[model samples]
Target: MKNVLHYKGYSAKPEYSAEDQVFYGKILGIDDLVDFYTENAKELEQEFHAAVDDYLAFCQEVGKQPQKEFSGTFNVRISPELHRKAFRKAQEDGIALNKVVENALTEYLSPAWHENRTVILPEEMAKMYSAEEQTVDTAPDDASHLALWKRNWTVVNGRTEMKKRC
Candidate 1:
């Protein structure tokens, strides 16, 4: 079963509060924090729509714009070590660091694409597969697909490891 309810392109992650006997969620990936809860499935749906409407109404009343959950651009600060690594990767891939990070985040968040049955294909895999291989029955699984990413190896502490950073 689907866990989230979507409204106006915003999605709320579903969780159960056992102690409170209710289903609750936080609208994710937005600047503003919005919390919603309800005791039953029927009420939960209504509450979800109400929460979104109220948030928009509140923003209108306050003369502020409501934020979309994702805007395709955001800042993230990483360590100096990662900074050096990502720069090197960008150079090797012949792409910008921003594109590298964007691709990585897209791959990492593939599961979150379920709402529209969408997918984020890795660069190598997208090229590796034939059009026929794109079928659901022929598609690769998580474990095997992950192995493809591990092909290029490096020695870290005298052991072989894959570079997972973007």
Candidate 2:
């Protein structure tokens, strides 16, 4: 019989059996463990591949950027109730509670306005934009697309007019 590992704050000890490890390790895409001891190695590989593809698709849809490594942190104290709320929210959001608190504090301290707008195009639209046949002179009929182009064009024209006056 394998020993169980107790996760902090949880009453139940998680079974550390080879079968349990195989299941979780496959879910986490740890191929080495799955291949070494799992009987359903082929199925685990397929599942891992599918998960990676799904994650990639989700990242593309959501415009997720590569995570950057953070090197420093500052400590702050909060009320127990607030801490508990944050912890609950973090669990619901599938993020670390510390990250949730940091994000909240960062947003609170930062100004609402941003210097640049990051645009993410759908795969088809991105392909269209990258194609040499598409020219800036061609206007798109979509209202939101037209609005963005008009806004930037207006800014450039305004800058040019200001330059002429000066």
Candidate 3:
């Protein structure tokens, strides 16, 4: 079950108030503290949507721009040793430290970053298997479809081992 609600490009992490018997949430990733609450679980989503609409309407009335979830600028802390190493690397590459960090983040977030991960696309599978054997109808990018493979990999004594989960 999802603990967060999303509406109009905004999200909120809601909590249940056992004492008050209401589901309440505050707008996330924004400077303003916008909140919503509903006594009925079925109306929780409607309340969240109404809150977002009201917030947007109010911003428009006041001529104030609504805040986006992410601003693309955030501070990250690192160890002195790691910082020095990154600085030297950035200097050697003739780029700013920010660019170096951005490149590292990009590479880390890339789908192929997991070396042991094995994802066979439809076209790739066609080369090895017969058409009759191809039963995967969902897109390869669908995480739920990929999870159905039930293949697990773990490092065992410095060696990667692939095992099937029961």
Instruction: Using lDDT, give the best candidate's number.
Output: 3
| Tens-digit per-residue lDDT, 24-137, candidate 2 | 232232222221223464554344455445555565798973233345676767789878888888899899977887787797577642233333445554554443333233
Judge candidate 1 at residue 8 and give its lDDT. Answer: 86
| Model 1: per-residue Cα lDDT over 1-166, one tens digit each | 5577888877887788899999988777567888889888678877878888888899999998788555668788878998999999899989999999888889768874323222455556455454532222222245454443223333332333333312
Q: Candidates sorted by TM-score, descending order?
A: 3, 1, 2
Model 3 clashing residue pairs (backbone): none
Stretch of 10 with least lDDT, candidate 2: 157-166
| Every candidate's lDDT | 0.68, 0.43, 0.74
Distance from true position, residue 87, model 2, in Å? 0.4
lDDT of 2: 0.43
Shift in Å, residue 31, candidate 1: 3.6
Alpha-carbon shift of residue 141 in model 1 (angstroms): 15
Q: What is the Å distance of residue 112 in model 2 from its true position?
A: 1.2
Tens digit of per-residue lDDT, candidate 3, span 26-135 = 88878899999999988888898999999999999999989865667999887899899999988998999999888989987997565555443455434554433332
Candidate 1: minimum summed lDDT over ten consecutive residues — where?
A: 132-141
